[model samples]
Target chain A: MGRRNDHSRQEIREMALQVAEKIVAKEGLQGLNARKIASAIGYSVGSLYIVFENLDDLILQVNARSLDQLYTVISKTEQQCRQPDACLLALGQAYLEFAMEQPQRWRTVFEYQRTKDAEIPSWYRKKIFRLFKLVEKPLLEFMPTLEPHLCAQTARALWGGVHGICILALTGRLEIVGADSVQNLMELLITNYLAGLKNVQGTPCTPEEGTTQECKA
Target chain B: MGRRNDHSRQEIREMALQVAEKIVAKEGLQGLNARKIASAIGYSVGSLYIVFENLDDLILQVNARSLDQLYTVISKTEQQCRQPDACLLALGQAYLEFAMEQPQRWRTVFEYQRTKDAEIPSWYRKKIFRLFKLVEKPLLEFMPTLEPHLCAQTARALWGGVHGICILALTGRLEIVGADSVQNLMELLITNYLAGLKNVQGTPCTPEEGTTQECKA
Candidate 1:
């Protein structure tokens, strides 16, 4: 119990986050609290407050780490696929896999809310934007003529749809949609959305035009 | 206090639900509990149990009502817009409007979870399936030759996208996407998704082909 003084502040902070993540992963967000974290790490509640502003701050840090890990997963998909469309499909699949694998932690990223009026911290916002850029990079290549602003918008909308599918499927609400696996649904969503994006931009290389050569089969 | 015995059992049940909705609407799901509901209704927690099995049961009932109200809002859009495309757009807009208007309650519909592995009750499932049918009706009309199963999947996908947009926007995560309003994002989603569906089916009338006549501007 007295071991708290042995570790430096940074070490304590990192240890607290790891313990918190494990709690959330096992019991979901409802299970996380400062007391639990402090006790698990053999620290006083007072010491826990010294490192973070409040419980919300602690949760935000945990979510930020989750987002970073998610960004890493999505980034890896980019190197694995050559085409932008294929890259997006890979990213979507990776995202779904991450959500399924770490349902609690991944959900806490979106489900955790601060007070209504509090601004999202800029550092966290930066991480979210970085995640968007992962999608935007390939989208811009796929639709070269899309305005910079429109490209960002398209990226958010598409990824939001992908996220929505993951949420519904994981939550069991997706059962209403029938027997298709989440992977098949993700493929359908990405394929149709890209087809629509191409159509909107008046791009000549339609998926239908040359299914094998132009689009990933 | 004197009015408690004056009402029938059904009236008491309805009153409890209305009170619970206000709590959830104002303070979110975390704020809801039988003690609070009983206190507000001037009844004992025992009476609450008589009407509902537990807090989860009460929440499920509340969610069912929310779904029914949502279905009504969407159904009204069907009458307001004659074209299937216009009707779907109207439905999407109405949905976003509903979410914005009652963000807390609308959120509880998706956010509330039963205890692990408990089957979602059939009555509630029926309400959810009914909601899906609302979308399915207009979708089937839009693409007549679409297979029945495909129509169901497409409806779920498109609505899931709409739902994703609402979740992101209402949570303030949409700020990263830029200056486009939620309505604009909603229009973009439905427009492009329908375009993709039409393309996938090789339909003769593409939105891009006749932007003014076939699709909403």
Candidate 2:
């Protein structure tokens, strides 16, 4: 958008993010740095600071993009499957595939460190919850009588588990659990957890007690 | 074990591990290194190499010790709980407690990168499997008719998910899912997943079909 010889502020921001993503992809989080990104994008480190508050700020922006990309992948998965149960399975599978394809981008989203009090930005948090809705959507469709809060909690628990499987699978530690395929392990979780939810569906949980273990009561 | 003037090879190795653990605890995995360990333990960096092969080997040793501590914590929890379901909850709680207490050590186990060709040593891996067995025992106890293979797969799926929740919880990202307590999410997963298993127990899964998504069939 700037003159042919010069990148505008917005152009510099995009260039910096692209370079940062490449550094993370090639070297993992430990290898990412302000100098490398600035050098890659043909800018001074001071220019990077002008665009990003700090390295942490840059990582956050990159993570926001990754989460959006993840949501797109899961949304497409959700659209293709007609049955709710199949949709959940397909979502988990899509999640694994996304992690496999973009392992570094996926890793840094969760692994980056924040200063002790640095709060996650609200808009970024929204992208994550939006993805959760992908899981919650199929979940609610499968069990219409389920309460909204429990549906949210269940989405977190199930997706959290699916997330754990992906971590191990990506790190080559899935073998520690003696499982071969991330898909089988994921399917086992979705199918079994769903069957379990149905068994407990007869007992409705009140809002006050929904967060407790006795919700099963 | 060594004379007052000098440490034995084994003593130096232990001292290096302790120093490494301390560095990791205070500054995380990035701060850990042979020079730091050598300085803290009062040995030259060359002495560290003489005692251990490399920093990777040192991390594996430290991780082995962390896994052992994890096993000890979980084993004590397993011993106190009288019922299978209770044991699972207590184990999940114990895991959270351990991670909360030793955040860096627990994190480095899964987060460390070995060289692409580096294989996890068998003995180090055994400690991981040993922890898995603690989960498997209660799973088998909860359902006697469940086949060994399915039980193992279920344990991995369940524990892997729990691990995921723990990672999010420690990193302060657990709030992203709108869940307040890791314990509640962990319980929801275990209880719901077990109840689901109970629903499907009548449908025996032969080993041939166990790993497939069609296991539900």
Candidate 3:
């Protein structure tokens, strides 16, 4: 296991990310520490810093990879389904399955809190927005004339709901509510939310409900 | 702050919970530890065990109180809104406000993991279910013909979606998506999901889409 001095800096960075992801997968984010990751990758703690800024940096690298994995899963699911509406269902099902299978890894993407002042790089931000765009394409395909801003809002709202369902399922909170199938919750959400979105003739706002700031929002 | 000796058994328990909650409130679950809480309350580590079964039990108590406060907020919001649908919007807004105001405390209710063998007690189960019931009633009141099973499923999905929005907002992930208003996301989710549910003629299923297990689910 001790391959120390054999690996280059980039190689060490890759090894550390793999090891960090494994630690998080096995024991959740609680088990990830600099000492453990450094030792597992057969390097000194100092070497870890030389390759990455800090532990947060290492964690961010791992989470970035996780997001890439999710985008792959969602994009592939989107391609396989014929109808945009059906594609939405498939996308949510893929999301739910991914979270269920690699529950910890999926969660760490959302759960890991970066340090204050450490801005999420533009590249990382694009990866996140790409996931949204994957959802946005099908929504646009499903409804041709929806406002551009409304479409973005819909993508976030829909994906956020799907994300929430997965989080509860992984955390065991859904069990207490007697939600036996994560699939059902996902379907119920997508089915109803889509139908609701379609019911709006033009804009989503109704005149009587214009008092809330969100009516304009 | 140093009322250790003068306090009775119950007072110590209460004191320990208050200190633990304050720690969680400020520093989040990451900052909570037995030594920190015990020391803050002017008690010994051994003394903590005598008062509560363990730290998990103590955290559970704090989470329980948080649930009560949530119930108070939601119940009050429900009373103030006249229509059942308006009540649902108010409930979501209230939930969003509570999470935004006390993010760590609200998050602790979901994020804190109990021990492996720890079966959450019936009282805890009831509290979780009560939150669902509050959402369930409005869903039923809005559409009385919704099947009982369907009503429960709807509540979980809608609330789960709302929850996902809140978690992202608190974690700062929403900022990357350029979502300025949590309330707007909440309203968008509710507005569309409800409209989608109503658009279904009688059952939520179309005849052609009968293959999905959740069609019946």
Candidate 4:
């Protein structure tokens, strides 16, 4: 009976996470609740707490799994690219793709405030930092001349840039600007950001100023 | 009596928004509710719906107000910057500053998605487009040779990049990278993105490989 209960506990945890994702995806974060989750699984409210300490714990677990999936995408994309620069761009693309494909999960991760409090859970921070380190590798290769501090600063800016595009695109805010494809928008951003890095060393180089060529995909 | 009811309705709406903002700032988006809002303002629950049809309407109004305030900051910053490029960078700084200055309002605007609708509110769309046109002016000035479509694309990318940085910085995600100031991060992103725009018509650019010179602020 104890073994059976243990198996059931894992099942319950998985079940709760699946339901949470559905609610978050379909109904936004506002729809999440213990009772709603319980009804979805046809279990009593108390049963959920037995496996998960509280709603916060369950959410942390759900996000942990979701972030792990994000890590996989980043790693796979990074590993697949042969050239270092291409690898960096691919990494940015993958980051944006994840958000576009999975808007619900992406929004939840951004919306939740993961603080230092014990009640907030540490897995959230762990998953997030791991994702950052993923991009940092490609960034280091992409800009070998940058100091450690500047590299960090530049990486944060890159991440911010990619994230900004992804969120706006995911939320349909890009419609205000008349974008045909999210990919094209991001390509421009990454390309422009990379070109700017060339100017960072105080050189009078013009990526676009000297060339009369037109920008195409 | 009708006039008195109208006055009370407006006052109640204002009071509810204050409470909602306070709760969101203190506890995150999940803490928002009609019950808590009513309690915070020393009113009955029904009093809230008298002004707002439901919680969604209340949140919509709150976010609308938040957006107006954000646009005001952007306009004020633009007035001070004489150069188009400087004004664009200043706009980016203003965005980050708004996030830091009013963390709760920022979160509400980004984090709160409508439950039943994937489409953004019409008024919200209009406000966002107005903001986009602001970026267009500097972009056209900086890239005199680009066609209208490409220039619009560049503005969208810049907007996304700036928004992404603001979301990350406000949530303390940038702290992990040891990035000291949001302004530095914005400057780095804006400068890089602009370089790409200037030359994106040329051969595709790689960020780290380009000739970036540090400019004196």
List of clashing residue pairs for candidate 3: A195-B196, A196-B195, A196-B196
| CAPRI-style class, candidate 2 | medium
Cα-based lDDT for every prediction: 0.79, 0.82, 0.84, 0.73
Off by over 4 Å in 2: A1-5, A203-217, B1-5, B204-217
* Residue B147 local lDDT, model 2: 79
Recovery fraction of native interface contacts for candidate 3 = 0.76
Stretches of candidate 4 above 4 Å error? A1-58, A119-127, A202-217, B1-65, B104-125, B176-178, B201-217
DockQ of each: 0.23, 0.56, 0.58, 0.34
DockQ of 3: 0.58
| Backbone clash numbers for all candidates listed | 0, 2, 3, 20
In model 1, where do residues sit more than 4 Å from their true spots? A1-4, A53-55, A115-118, A176-179, A203-217, B1-5, B116-118, B176-179, B203-217
Report how far off residue B66 is in candidate 3 (Å).
Answer: 0.9
The CA lDDT at B39 in model 1 is: 90
After TM-score superposition, what is the CA distance of residue A197 in candidate 3 from its true location, in Å? 0.5
- Can you tell me the CAPRI class of model 1? acceptable
Candidate 2 C-alpha lDDT tens digits along B147-208 = 77778888888888889989889987787669857877888888788878887675556454
Candidate 4 TM-score versus the reference: 0.71
Can you tell me the CAPRI class of model 3?
medium
